[model samples]
Target: MFRLAALFLALSPATAFACGQPVCLVDPDSLSLTKIITFEGERAGAGPGHNIDDVLPLQGATFGEHFAGQSVGARGPHDEVSGDAFAPLTMMAGRAGQNLSLVHFSGNTVLNGYGSAGFPKRDAQGEGAIAVLFDQDQSALAFDLRGGEDGAALVHFYRRDGSFIGPVPVQPTGEFAVAFLRSDGHADIAGFVLTNTDPQGLALDSLRFGKPPDMS
Candidate 1:
């Protein structure tokens, strides 16, 4: 009788042991923490030639030290605005100490499009590089990039502990493009450094933060 029972259990369907399974399948796309916003909801201004910088706090993100009392339309040479010249930027819904800063390069922190009245012009300033730092750990980040006339722009992401994540290349184009990055199963995206070969440098707009909509 014992031998007969053992043979019956061994021949049972695999579903009989489903409760003892050690692994469960998970969808990777469901685990993603990033999303891209093309700013389609917001107006792109009258036309490509018209640039607007007065718009702020769009989609919960702020530019430069504007929230910290910096005036809008402020322009300075790369040397003057680089480093700790401006206070770190913060998001409206971000944590108390969570902030973002621009380092080692100068250009308008807020510009709607490529060619505004006071937009920086292409110069012989050599290759320009900017470091964007986030004070708190984030799983995703994105921004609109434009005005690269010389060569492609490269962005390198880093972990919260300052470890390298990877590099993304942005081709020089006449129109604005979106560059988005996210960590895989890790919320360690601390910051990124962008270097551009364009003589006119690069302009960033419509900065986005937070997780993807589906993840919410």
Candidate 2:
């Protein structure tokens, strides 16, 4: 029975991801981020899966740090066989059932709601904000996002002083798309702010950054 359970877990991408203790490595005042990618979980299932409480945020794992206060409050790992009805991102069809799955994201990292357990991908609120405080100064940041065609999502950058910088408008493409952002004045990065206007915010994933000048 134990072997069967293990096999079931292995063969299915709907298994919850294991959460551990890995302190923040990126020093907000040190190395800069260059580039980021999409999270397909290696096409593990039929859609994108995120492990709530994943300690590693640098490599795509994200928790509700900004809202949860002290690195807690994840939606629990999600490895269900859900369908990706989003048009722009239908490419993520799961591999097992031959349905589109986001099995292979740019890397294995992703935001499990980044700042809260509430998944904002389907949020219908007119406006909302989510933030993530980094251990390192992020001079620049970028990520892959998808949203409803009518809604608009903006990625905001903040400095160490907790001052808001500029907002990069994420065009509603209704599909998985990449958005790049740099400090308006080449300031060091402290936190990332994602705001949704109109219908709701988009689904954000992966991340790459370094110096503001180096646009990877």
Candidate 3:
């Protein structure tokens, strides 16, 4: 306990994720949420401006196997997805895997095997993409969105139990929440964020979740 406290103290106030900032949100149903982790280029040691569209099975990432508890998973061009530390959370195995639950896309999209430092700007490419995260069971759940400078980034949601949510709009910043899984069971989901109105539509940071109802 002392060592952990000391580590926290030793960390700079600017330390990513630990800065105690609230995550941005986009849920009209008022889904409860807490920021379980924050993306930091320094911790990942990959620094700022890393490639958000790298191919799956990325090598030498800072997030080894998982972040918080949910493993990192993203779908790429070849019907393949990779997770943190090169784990293939591919869709060929029924969009379910030992490390992943399901994958989705509104268009040809990919998930970031590891998190990055910034959100998208006004002219970024890559449209119609979303991310979903969870464990083998329904215990863990969540995903990410890249904020934009134009209008609110709205998305059409698909839930784990094959339900739908949204036309939800996430503001450029501050504690956004939406549901993809069952509200009471597993919040599994795949969402189709509309095509970027601006160039930098959805460049994202590490979308964090998992831990439990209290976000502990």
Best candidate, TM-score = 2
RMSD of each: 14.9, 18.6, 13.9
lDDT for each residue of candidate 1 in 1-216, tens digit (9 for 90 to 100): 775555334323342234332111122222232433334444332222222233223434332211222222212312111221122332121111111222222233323222112232223122233445555555545565655564566665555444456666666533454434342335565555555555454555545555544422
Stretches of candidate 3 off by over 4 Å are 1-37, 41-48, 52-122, 125-128, 136-147, 161-166, 171-195, 211-216
lDDT: which is higher, 1 or 2?
1
The CA lDDT of each predicted structure is 0.38, 0.37, 0.30
lDDT for each residue of candidate 3 in 1-216, tens digit (9 for 90 to 100)? 775555333322233224232222323222323443334322121112233332122211122222221232333211112222122222211121211111122321223222121123112233223333233223222444443455344443333333343334455522233333232233333322222233333443434443224424
Per-residue lDDT value at 165 in model 3: 39
Provide the lDDT at 25 for model 2. Answer: 18
Shift of residue 104 alpha carbon in model 2, Å: 7.7
User: Alpha carbon lDDT of residue 40, candidate 2?
Assistant: 43
Please rank every candidate by TM-score, starting with the best. 2, 1, 3
- Give the Å error, residue 185, model 1: 3.4
Instruction: Give the higher-TM-score candidate: 1 or 2.
Output: 2
Residue 146 local lDDT, model 3: 41
Off by over 4 Å in 2: 1-56, 59-130, 176-185, 197-201, 212-216
Separately for all candidates shown, the number of backbone clashes (residues 3 or more apart, or on different chains) is 0, 45, 18
